[model samples]
Target: MIGNKAVYAGWKAAGMPDMLNGDDHFAYIVGYSDKTVHPQNGITRVAVATIFFRLLTDKVRDANSTLTNNYSDISRGIWYDHAVSTLSKMGIVKGDSHGRFGPNAPITCAEAMTLIDRVLNRLPESRDDLLNGMIQWSDNTDTSKWYYLVVQEAANSHYDDIKSDHHEKWTKLRDTRDWTQVEK
Candidate 1:
């Protein structure tokens, strides 16, 4: 319930419908229920919800800006309008060649990675050293698999272990875990 309302409020605070995306998908304003499911032509609540949360993340403020919106699409809900515009402006997403962001489309790994890369750069100069490399630009060493190079550089700088990526050690990427309390 809170998530749904937060999404709605976020969109309203920005603008309304954004014409950048032609998607006139349904808005999950009414909080999700057990029976709720995406029909043939509907957007998932997860994507919408995550975008809402991202607005409140530390990265947004670090960008030296606040989320703003302007309604370009009249058919979509105010929620979609605001979310799309804000996302596009943030450079996290973009419209196709025809100048229309496909709001209903599922975001891909490349897009998520690009967004996170941008956020990493916006961290404060006083942020933990572990995150410093990301803030300070570095010379491109390895061209192929730039992402892999980044992960390796992070390890070399003592921020994380190299095993995180090479070992497919996804567990290490978690924000929280009861490693001390987990039953073996």
Candidate 2:
């Protein structure tokens, strides 16, 4: 959660509630969870939907708001109804062919990248541009992944330097035996 910590701190510094530290309302308000359920294990489809809604609106939640969802798995009165409905109306999100939003399903990297691009107000670059910017990844070539453009744009926006710095730090830490449990 290192990536999110800075954002959390910034939110707190901006006079917003420090909701990132186990605040159930944060998840519920954003439709990432139903208050009773938690998404701490990972990002989920519902969380993506919630983030989309939040990026587009200031009023994140309303107890009196009711939104009809087309997803077969999402019924009326669900905690995510408002956020999901807003995203649906904006065409920012879609359900599976089976008409399921899969609220509890873990979000894929491509999905996360797409959402982040949208949040950043990034329009899709041409396929040619994406192809031209392709870079090699440890496991796969950038173009092989569906999120190639999103990732490439992220790198172009300076994430590559940040990633390299982190890699160097991790390598140094590994050599020093200060940490060995690093995953990849």
Candidate 3:
């Protein structure tokens, strides 16, 4: 977002609290929890895996990435570290310059769009496979709202069960032109 107000409106339209302003953007993802989940130090391994599994669908045939093993070694730092291993294994996320994914850092809207795009790209593609995926989870130069494009793609692809919370943002964004800020 170019300005704080636009970013604030976009997040608010994306079903976030009005109080979450820029630099405070990440509060939308973690602030909802009564307690803060530290990406490297505060989060649990199992907690991250569970979130990844929820994004899986019928045709996502990645057995190795299923993460059904003893993840005891990874309870190291931050909540997103767990997400990195599985998501990276699934070819969805990557880390830092030294190969470290800052799981605790606040992600910008553009980066979030690209991340969702990467995950969607990994899914198996087949004709009429409704359960395969949906929304425009790509970083199209023309996609007015990259976030909504991903959400809509998930919906269109029939990605089994995204929490209704994210979907509700789509409705509000469609109803209001609040997402334009991200475009600017």
Candidate 4:
């Protein structure tokens, strides 16, 4: 079975408070509790999804703190609740047509790319050039596919308009060169 050390390290690196020692809620909120343990070898998809959302929005929060149960699949008090709610409110992510977030389901590559694109677009200093560059995926560019345009924009670099903004400052965490080389 995989140990908890990696999750602990990730939690700390994401600026989460170091309260995993004895706080059950903290561990669960950050997805590091004993319940996250996987007997086979790896963490569950829900656990990873919770962690991913936490890492992405650790430095941000919705002031309202309203409980928007947008997904029937995600219950209240789960590790990913607030993060998912906030992201959903910001339109960075969305549930399925049937109103299911499927928190436990593994995200497909198309979904991952679409999420990345949407987040980048939400950034104040979005790299439109990089996003509109090219079509990398050979098979998934159908306009009907939800991820078609997102993948195309994520793989291309058509604009170079640069400006200063909070998103620009935040995106500095990852170098621009990396986006230029996004996988097809």
Candidate 5:
């Protein structure tokens, strides 16, 4: 698994504008109170929520900001509260069967892929359709796995399409100066 610092550097190199200034800016990832991003540690669910929420346009966020959920673990004024609420409203994130959001839990691969699919609007209408397109990784052949179809869909996405989509978002952010400046 990649670390937070590497992910941040990669995104910056890929034309994602820095958004790590003060309170006016929205950082996609942030370090813990110890002033370290824990480069080798797995990312938590709340961190993922914050990242995706920062990646969203302000218009979308504003539209969904008032929406709320019933996750027992989420308090109203936490750092990730708004992000979690917005994502839950958009159906990009969900709590467990016990109605717990598990904010600090290390997110699983399947859960991450599901969030990606939801945010990208790439979820297939039927999992059966993706079986034929599946890539045959030795450990990934299990059709019953919940992530099977989403993983296959990601694997099958054309390189050009992915590049184009990323470029489009980058260009939009750049043009609008929507992102905050990183502190030097």
Candidate 6:
């Protein structure tokens, strides 16, 4: 499990869109009521969903917040309801065969990679494209896993294009965006 500080630093380094403004500080990863972030502990599925949703541009969040999903375990009007629903509507998330989204479960590496790839619209053209000396996984020989390709693509791909495209598309929207509109 990575720390919240590390995640924030990585997000900044990746050039991902943010909602912060001068004298207005915000954090996607909030601490518990006790004021401890528990950075070493594994993050839950619901927490990951909320973090990803918070990372989106305000325009995108408003446009997709009303979307719905059929995850039996998720109750409407909960804290993570909108995040899960919007991500599901955008095809960034999917439930299991029993239609259950284990919100309390710890997010797996494969699930995280899949979510990130889907958000960035990254799809490798060929297996060879992911093996150009960029990926250096210890278990590279384990090709039978369902998330093998996505993990490889994430490790090999660069986020410069994604960062540029997001900035270009949302610059105008960001100038007049309102964070108060969304339910935190």
Q: Can you write out model 5's per-residue Cα lDDT over 61-155, one digit (the tens) per residue?
A: 78788436799999988878999998898788999889999999999867877776666555654443443433466666777877776665544
Pairing residues by index, what is the TM-score of model 2?
0.52
Q: Could you give me the TM-score of model 1 versus the true structure?
A: 0.35
Ranking by TM-score: 5, 6, 4, 2, 1, 3
**Candidate achieving higher TM-score, 1 or 6:** 6
Which parts of model 4 are misplaced by more than 4 Å? 1-31, 34-49, 56-59, 122-133, 160-184
Query: Which candidate, 3 or 5, would have the higher lDDT against the true structure?
Result: 5
Candidate 1: RMSD over Cα atoms? Answer: 13.8
lDDT of 5 at 146: 72
TM-score of each: 0.35, 0.52, 0.35, 0.54, 0.66, 0.65
Q: Name model 1 segments beyond 4 Å from true.
A: 1-54, 57-77, 122-184
Give per-residue CA lDDT, model 2, range 44-160, as digits (tens). Answer: 797768765654433333422348778888777786778787676655567878988889998876566566554443434444433333344554454655666655444332211
| Model 3 per-residue lDDT tens digits across residues 109-169 | 5455445445434122222222322334345425344344443443232223333332221
| lDDT scores of the candidates, listed in order | 0.38, 0.50, 0.40, 0.49, 0.64, 0.65
- Candidate 6 residues 9-121, lDDT tens each? 12233544333122324578887899999977888998998887877777677877764789999998887899999988877788888999999998887788777766656
lDDT (tens digit, per residue) of candidate 1 on 100-144:
455556654334444443333311111221332342334333435
Q: List the residue pairs that clash in candidate 6.
A: none
Looking at model 4, how many pairs of residues clash?
6
Candidate 4 global TM-score:
0.54
Question: How many steric overlaps are in each model, in order?
Answer: 7, 0, 18, 6, 0, 0
Top candidate by lDDT = 6
Tens-digit per-residue lDDT, 61-168, candidate 4: 434243486688879887677767766776666789999988867666556655655544423232232333344566855556666555555444343333454232
Compared to the true structure, candidate 3 yields what TM-score? 0.35
